[model samples]
Target: MIDLGALAKITKAFKVIDNDKSTNRLSHAYLIVCQDAENLEGYMRYFAKQLLCSESVPCESCRHCSLINSNAHQDVFFYPTSEKGILTEDINAIISESYVRPIESEKKVFVLSNAQTMNAVTQNKLLKTLEEPPKNVYILIGTTSEQAILPTVKSRVKKVEISPFSKTVLINALIDQCKDREKLENAVACSDGTLGKTLALYQDQNLKNVIDLGIEILTKMQSSKDVLEYSTKIIKNKTDLDQFFDVLDMLLRDTLVKECGDQSLITNPNALNQLQNANFKNGALISIISAVTDARKRKQFNANQNMLIEWLLFKILEEKFRWQKL
Candidate 1:
């Protein structure tokens, strides 16, 4: 279980929900949208404890909280027990079971994890129950994609948007988990505000190698002739290619910041010397950033990996030399 107390955003959210419950204004249904699905599920369980616990503030030591923490609660139901995600059958089960009285607590909590996986048909099936659930029944739907949910379904539930943590909050939360300060900073820089991705990047042993390759490309691959060799070294696999692109994009942006004489805004502070020595002008950095964005888009659309890498490298070199000649 995630230490929800350590997460600032989640702690704030808990207070908001607690306030609602205190004022007797709790919504019957809530739609929580978060990019980090795994952590979202853990949060939902904690939310369940918030609703079911005997104490005004959830005493994690209580029977309700302990049952929820252990995933042994009789009243709290988590859907998509299989990797198949929330299906029509799961919706049917929820609907049928929601009408039943709670055995352990006054309120029955149903959580649908990965709610985005439910297509139009499944969502439509869930629309009625979502609109008017049984008395003392609370439903929580979590999705990474908010746009995928039907407008009617969205309208019925209170939308809870979980924003990414600030640099300070994330760093504080991860301090004890990761002892390496430099690697932790690098992971946080690349995390884009999501804790799951931050932890994944922090634990990734190959991340340093990927960053080194990105630096090599930016500082050493000066000529168009170097594209092929660099491309081969960068494109080990799709995942590695994506990581390389992230590092390259980050480094280029940091170099642009350095060029603008704003050292404070640089994400890769440890690479300051390299960024300082990088001779690429503002125009070149901007062009390279655009190329990286385009390349990432192409990658998503299943573009030929080799050709895409080659094209991106050529564009980077072209922009670098073009601006230098000016």
Candidate 2:
């Protein structure tokens, strides 16, 4: 069995679960939700190992341990989104697997990663399975947000919150992944306390490049030509466009903070002077924030990327130009 010694919150949660198991009062299902999807994987694995272990502590050397380690355990089922992420078929398979008897272990463990991706219909289908969980079975539904889960389903399962990691923890995790200084800082700022995203940015060189471009676009709000040129880079990558917007928003927020003289919270300390010089009044800042938010929403509905860029750039230019003229 893997020991959950690294994460303090996880260990504490495990203690509660362990107490219940010892008292013969284990819950049928659990819902682990967090903003950081990466942490959820380790916590889930540790919990699954404990459930599958024959001893009080999972002996990582046992036969069951070998199966779990080798991922040969007949009873432990894991479901996640394929290339497209969670789908209806994935949910159906979980429902089907729940009925199967354990091949060797005393109990079965079902792990549903990104359970928040379940649509309304799939969620309803899973609710039925939760209502009547099989004997000697445990279901773990992993989600980024409890709100994504249906209210009925959320009510059925016990909830555990996994908070996002601190910037220091995220930075240490990114050390192996980040090579460029700009990418490192941008990833740390954009991850919003999620180590998984930071590592992903490190591994996916393209994403790091996009974030670097995003920073350039936001920080260099000098000329109208510069604005249009940089905005185009952000609009080019459809995949990372959402994250690009997040970075842009953060940059604007930092500029706002600097304008308001809140230097303590500035992430881009090196660019604070430039940000202060470009700072808009509260009204202009709010307007631009709203515009960026709308642009993000437009992205969700297959909005035209080029026109979206034109719209946002024009909006900002109009606001800033108007402010300068006044």
Candidate 3:
């Protein structure tokens, strides 16, 4: 059966699998692309189920289905095996494991998450497997950006790209997981339409602090010393650099929406009045938002996190004050 849960946005990818299954022509290699690592792993599980199911479609009740979904299947190996990312030793282990045939299902699947973590040696080892996979062997590589992977490594696999869901789709999926409506709404507002990120941001205890910091930056714009101090305070510590920017972007977006007089579109409704009275006009807010978007794109390329975020904060400050003249 089709995995409706994970592949909703990338139905085309699912369709390829279904068609292949119908024709008994499943590709030996697949690269599942996504920005969120957690979500990419979920899709890996989904595809594993699709590959190992005994019935014409995956019956959720079957033992194989259960094992695959739980990530307990004996023949399935998840690469980079730990948070430490892929190492030469791990690659050796994977190469050693690939020789074993499936014990439970008709096929053996190797799942590589954050596949870009593989260095040249590791990837070269993997390339040997891809060049001549054994019978009933499938290798699945999960990555946020295909660019992070070497072009040679990418060439062997059929690429399946999955994008973030729309706000409506994201909120609907979150409704079951999040009970508090207000917090849920806030998460939905700040989310980049990826459930992994939405849950992460929603469950973050320091999210309020981050958001408050952004607002503080805006509110204290009249005093340069306060902005500089606030920036230093937030930047000095180790942090989830991505989430920090996500929070700042949300605050900026809310202010931008408020500037347009669209109350219904406001994500941070409680801060409507404060945002409306902020130092930026519509054009300045738009310019800052554009800069934030560009900065986010840069982050995907593995930009120096501290330098990028610090630069972005300063850019926002510059725009906020520069626009007062406009």
In model 3, where do residues sit more than 4 Å from their true spots?
1-12, 54-58, 70-75, 80-105, 216-220, 223-244, 257-274, 290-325
Which candidate wins on lDDT?
Answer: 1
Q: What is the C-alpha lDDT of each candidate?
A: 0.83, 0.70, 0.74
Give the per-residue lDDT digits (tens) of candidate 1, residues 1-326.
Answer: 33564572355566677777888898998888878876878767767888888776678898888998798999999987888889999999999999999999889999887898998999999998987789999998889899989999999998877788777778788888788998998898777787899899999988877777777777888776799888876666444778878888888888877767667667778855665556788999999999999999999999999999999999989999899999
Whole-structure CA lDDT of model 3: 0.74
Residue pairs clashing in model 2 are: 1-58, 1-59, 1-60, 81-85, 81-86
lDDT of 3 at 196: 80
In model 1, the runs with Cα more than 4 Å from the true position are 8-16, 54-57, 236-239, 259-265
Question: Which of 2 and 3 is the better model by TM-score?
Answer: 3
Minimum summed lDDT over a 10-residue window in model 1 is located at 1-10
TM-score for all predictions?
Answer: 0.89, 0.68, 0.73
Which ranking of candidates, highest TM-score first?
A: 1, 3, 2
The residue pairs in collision within model 3 are 1-58
Q: lDDT tens digits, residues 250-307, model 3?
A: 7777777766766666666755455655667777778887887888899899988666
Q: Candidate 1 or 3, higher lDDT?
A: 1
